[model samples]
Target chain A: MSNTPLLSTRGLTCRFGGLTAVDRVDFDVRPGQVHAILGPNGAGKSTLINLLSGELRPSEGEIHYRQHPIHGLPAHRVARLGIGRSHQKTNIFPRLSCLENCRLAARIHLGGVIASWRSRAAARQVDERAEQALATCLLTHRASTPASAMSYGEQRQLQIAMVLATAPTLMLLDEPLAGMGREETSRVTGLLRALRDDYTLVLIEHDMDSVFALAEQITVMVDGRVLETGTTAAIRGSEKVRDVYLGRHQQEQA
Target chain B: MLHRYPKRVPIIMLALTVLLVFYPLWGPVLIGDGSDFFLEKLTLMLILGLFAMSLDLLVGVVGLVSLGHALFFGLAGYTLALASPSYSAASLWWMMPLVMLVSALAALVIGALVLRTRGIFFIMTTLAFGQMLYYLVSDASFTGGSDGVFIMFKPTLAIGELTLIDLESPLQFFYFVMGMTLLTYLFLHWLIRSYFGQVLDGIHDNEHRMQALGYATYGYKLAAFVISGVLAGVAGMLAAMQYGFANPAQLGWHLSGEVLMMVILGGMGTLFGPLLGAFAYELLHYAFEHLTLYWQLLMGLTIILIVLVLPKGLAGLILDPPRLRLPRVGVGGLLRPRPAASTKARLGLAGHHKHEEG
Candidate 1:
């Protein structure tokens, strides 16, 4: 497709000392699609998200987000450019109340940083957006609870709520569903599925069934390099993908 | 944790307000000493309290341990000292804002450089800058070098020909210091509760998360640092006006340690705690000085005893209605990370890489 991708990377590479963490790779993340990056634990999926979110600098590459070169920008700068990401470990303001955490995130998108002078009426938008995010994550009931008080699964949900509150055009969720019971996994999967309508989502997740179920497109990375980028059917049906990423268990199932 | 002002808080505030207003009359009576020295000590308490409160903005709100905070305080005092006191035209109109602006600018520059570092590095860099200012004043001829500079007369307030407040009188001067303290407290109270304050609090909890959520954390921190310095400068200005002197020692690392101790002893984050800590420290010093020349030793013992007993500092025992959470070791937990900070990268940005190494 010659159409402009929401976020595109060309020869993106990151090195820690002499070791290359993320090797030169390229992909075009189309607008309004759930592009899932599937990999083993050390496949550098998290590193890719880190580079995208500006947590780590790319050793070599160009990352264009909405036609702007954002590879070298700091995390906050990237965030200001309407790109938000979540951590695999459920990053959140643990001391702050759930609503407060969301409010802090929402205010950045809804208003200026120096908003001390603005009246409550003027900042009503921030509160509304925060509440909406909470509702979307089904965390409205626990809004007043400190984030630390929430169950781990609930905190994971709060993580999504936080990124959602930022109101980004594109979201890079790092392992949005890592540790979850059956119900929470489905709930988050449902949430991710719903988010596809509003946000261009790049999710790094290990849950194959969930990825296949939710993602329209998938990128399989092996040892910091992309094995293949294709539709779920293509990835599932590929012999190499089955042998390497899926293991022999997936081949027997096929 | 549950949080609320105690029922006695309003009563305490009202009582304190009433007592301060009637201080000239009742202050002499209640102290029993009823001496000029007693009143002066009380006034010093109020000014130092303001200084401690300013440091709290950095330590408590932003979770930034600034060791060079005394730079702004001493710089403002020195500005008043170095300037020609010959001009009677310098009123509250120009002087206060001017000192505040200079101090804020210094904080801005210092903050820009120091804020890039975190934890121990941030502390050491601030300490380094604090010493630089101390030495600059101590060695500079314009600053009176180590001998220090002196203000010829206290700053007076007037509008054109109108003589509004005559600061020469000790009682009036005392009230003026108290007025500034109250004003600073009010401004800070408003600030820490504002959207900016909440954002700073979020940044303190998890900077990376705040950044990920789209906040320019560095800007917020720099702004907070400037606000903190400006308030501190205001305190220094008041102190300079009162003492009619600006010593290089005021800029020294010693003062930084003292003020940090005050914030920690009073309770790091609470608005009123620093003031209480200042009062506690000053009073103990005063009481001990009266008894013996080796007052510092006794002062140290008392502070240690007090800190050990009230781990959350004076504010925990006296001001904060709710216990909230247990106090971590380290003054206001400056050395120890906040409870939430341990899990800060819970979404696992830094942690994910550890596995990458394996």
Candidate 2:
């Protein structure tokens, strides 16, 4: 709610043995903003998200969430702090039904943590919130369907819905449209655009059109460090970005 | 839609308990000759059934397969025999309490030690500890050495100037065992349906995810282990009381193997699977022992067939797998069918409307 950015990382660094996966990467994500972190394969985009999500501990640097230090917190604690994320891989409770999946996430939002033997009232609330989340992704009809039965695109939608049920202040979406077909991608893009009003999303995406359309600000990463960060237009016209990333593709397309 | 009979489950259990309690009364007319012997066998089966259920709680539901369950069962028997007077029937009151106390203590100590390791190491360690106890009992002279201690008379309950329980009466004793089984079954059912049960399921599915989700997986696992251990101990105490003797064979690895087979045969995770498996297996054993002298061979072959044929156990086939159903929603918020199916359902709805109009 404050003018301060929703999240800020100062000198964030991570090391795996002798290799550095994320190196002194300083980044800030403002409130109610769509900030996309763009990079090619093996560019530490995933590593950065893992660090921010508290899946991996940083070797050095501080991460402040809503102006409070949250670097060393566990994944659930980070989630409880109003930060929700979907994994790069379709990470969900596979055997559970679509509604059950959302219910699991929704329970995190409804007062206390949900255990297996929850009261009927808590169970009902979970079901209700899960249905609401499923509606948001237009998959409410498939609420009783198992996760395994869903198509790849629907699985992606369910993943987003699960994250949404957590009621996060900032959503870290890792490749939301990674393996979607054209129609599916457009549908998801439209959905993301629609959600822009209620959510401040930080997306790591490969789809240029969706990124450009949805993101107000873009930061480029190469070899685990932030190469540049600016408005979409500024990033588009950056000579260094063109020479390093876009040069080969721009020429080939032309 | 056909409604599930959730209430039927408990009703059936209550009926079965009543039948078991009065089994001797009817067993004489049904089985004909050696009715008392058969009832005794049933009592043994009931105790073993409880033992099997305890294992199922750990292996089937909690996802911790243990091979040393008989250790608790046999240990309690040993403790009861050692405490009771050898010259006469052990005082049922003293021996029963002692069996429970000693068995629980042994299980707690053993469970704590074995639970520290996991996977194959845990299995092997528990097996070793059980074998060690068996060996110690077999070699010890004061504990009747390898031959085991016997009871001169069945235990009886005495009240001042009033008669109470006569353990020699098969009907009275059978009811006692039945009561214990029902209590154990109900307690276990409640336990697995609790929040603790849910966490165990989560741990079973993905332990790391549970830890990341802020659950102390270690504490949850330990609690489940202790609960299973205590249940096994109670089964052992009842076994010792029923037989009026404790044998070194009670501690043998075969005892553990038999209980495990019962769990697997009945359906590891299913609620009543243990009871089913125990009864079926025991009855089969009785029939085989009478029909053929080589009952052990038949028992081994039958267990092999059950394992090979139904790895998920009998429960998976009988109980039906858990299914997910959609919650009822407001009419306006009803989920639209897939765009492809929408037209067909809409046509069906329209047909009903037109019929009403006509």
Candidate 3:
């Protein structure tokens, strides 16, 4: 378990008709490491994340987590096996209170959903854990607030908190900073930094600044293929990465 | 702090008290009075109310709008008829439990199979399964082979005194039915407010989100479907007992349609909505039966009118549906902008954390 990558994908390929969404992509995230997958639009970064999280099955290759294959398992089963994923869309339970969203997720982690319904004692304990999760997410003040009524940034935070409540050893975040204002992003980034030691995080982001700032290891993808993977500094220094991604920076200056 | 007891108990008790007390006194027609017509109507209403609530669990709470609930009810009726020694002879009290168990088992098997499909496919699949059961019972000689079976006696208590429930006396049967109906309501209310109930709501709002939260939504939906089926089945058994026989007509599509109408008319999701719908529906049936022989035609028209006019159902008119309300977050709570460009601020902190770990 010490040497094993929290999540590793080998030759993972997903094809839709004649077009390939992800083509023979190999990726890995070491334990407690923040691995960022960076790509332009339609670059298959999301498809790769989807495959790793068991939301989509690979047409080729295998996905291993903690040395066990998890390629074709249902998303819920994958979550149960210690991988928590937040969607690109803010997908927290809208009707549920902010606390309830986290609590239900935590309850799933404890495997008490079945007994919790009939047993008052079990439900009380789950509620307490849910409250604790809310506090951990800096959402204690809005514990009873419905997720539907939260500001866009708050909703995003709640989505991440909901995933955290699952108690996953590995976290898969698809574009966590997609729609956030600068302050919100900073607050969330601070929270993400605090979370670094507790779980392995795989983040997909178009925000270069956030990616460059957070990623220990960075993988760049283009047209469904992995172009490069290395330390962020190494990747930033690479001529290919500059030509493929940072060319836009030159174009903007021109 | 409010987690110690079932959340909806007090509300259910209040409703039951009003139903049991006022309805018997001024609601007209007592059982055992040669024409205990009103009492009989009340008993029928209670049975239908139970049926509607069962359907509501699937549709209102679980978001599975099913059309085959009556199949469980009708099948239970047939079970009681086949098991009893002559529809007139009193069946043992334990047999009622047996009937409910069998009906519930049928629901479980059926729910498990059909729950695999969703949306229109789910509705159509359940209807097909229900029709298959109806035809099977109608054709089978053991269940009176389409003509239906008559009970020789009412159900009797299995206790020391061998207390037989006298269905012949409308008042006794009325009280018994009322007690069972109230119990079913309470049980269902408890179930809906429990942790299981919240999960059901989650599944309803967003199943994908629930699954991601680590819940096996499929299992929860199947369980809810079974619970609803069993309740409907019990109501069916009671209906058979009251009517003194089980008929092929009881298993018909029209009966299924009628129950759907009752559910919608009362209010699809409200706890007392179904009971109110049943009461209104039964009263309409009573009036129509006296006024015209083609009463079903008028009843069908009435339901269509109700659907067109009050799509939210009766309960929606009286009460505001629950809404999500977030208490305002004051300005002091929101994080203020940092001086050195927030992204850079975050980057420095993230870098420091990483370096410390290294």
Q: Assess each prediction's global lDDT (C-alpha) against the native.
A: 0.83, 0.77, 0.79
The lDDT of model 1 is 0.83
* Of candidates 3 and 1, the better by TM-score: 1
The fraction of correct interface contacts reproduced by each prediction comes to: 0.55, 0.12, 0.48
lDDT of 1 by residue, B1-358 (tens): 1123566755765687677778778766766776567777778889999999999999988889988888888999987766635544356777887898899889989999999999999999999999988888888898888989878877778788787778877888888888888888888877787778877877766788788887788898999998999989998888888888899888888899999999999888887888888988897887899899999999899889988988878777764344446676767664555455336435333433332332
Tens-digit lDDT string for candidate 1 (A102-155): 888888876665552465664787789889999999999999987766777888
Give me the TM-scores of chain B across the candidates.
0.86, 0.81, 0.80
Q: Best-fitting candidate, measured by TM-score?
A: 1
lDDT (Cα, tens digit) per residue for candidate 2, span A1-254:
44688899999999999888899999999898899998767789989988988889999999999889999987778887778888776665555578877766776567544432357787677677789889999998999876656677988899899888877888999999988999999999998998888999999998888999999889898888998999899999999888766674566669
Clash count, candidate 1: 7
lDDT of 3 by residue, A97-214 (tens): 7888788888877756676766778778777777776777789999987665677788788888888877788999999988799999998888888888788899998777888888
Judged by lDDT relative to the true structure, which candidate is superior, 1 or 2?
1
Arrange candidates, best DockQ first.
1, 3, 2
Q: In model 2, what lDDT does residue B36 have?
A: 79
Candidate 1 fnat reads 0.55
Positional deviation of residue A81's Cα in model 1 after best superposition, in angstroms:
2.0
Q: After aligning candidate 2 to the native by TM-score, how far in Å is the CA of B192 from where it should be?
A: 3.8
- Among the numbered candidates, top DockQ falls to 1
